[model samples]
Target: MTGYSALNMQQKQAIAQYLQSLPSLVELDRDDGVGLKRALGNYWGQFLPEEIDSV
Candidate 1:
């Protein structure tokens, strides 16, 4: 994952602004009922059925 230090000035500023906006966003309900295995399955979409269920 790209660290904050790797970002340029504009990217850092954008991240700062996004962070400032996060408070209101945080007020929203965040539950999506998904976990790592299911999320990976959705994102990858190519895991074998048995592989997805194995863990």
Candidate 2:
């Protein structure tokens, strides 16, 4: 449940830059869908299934 507040200024800037670098629709039919999904999962939630057998 970490928040964006945990990211440093540099990290935030890097993310912004990555997002901005996406190609326009005319240039590419698809973009970095995988990276975007991972980033969203990390920023929004754990996204992983809970462990059922933790000791």
- Residue 50's lDDT in candidate 1: 33
TM-score of each: 0.39, 0.39
**Which ten contiguous residues of candidate 1 have the minimum total lDDT?**
42-51
Off by over 4 Å in 1: 28-55
Q: What is the C-alpha RMSD of each candidate to the true structure, in Å?
A: 12.8, 11.0
The C-alpha lDDT values of all candidates are 0.46, 0.53
lDDT of 1 by residue, 1-55 (tens): 3664576766655554554445457553334324333444453233223335555
Prediction 2 global C-alpha lDDT? 0.53
Clashes of 2: 0
Error of 2 at 19 (Å): 0.1
Q: What is the lDDT of candidate 1?
A: 0.46
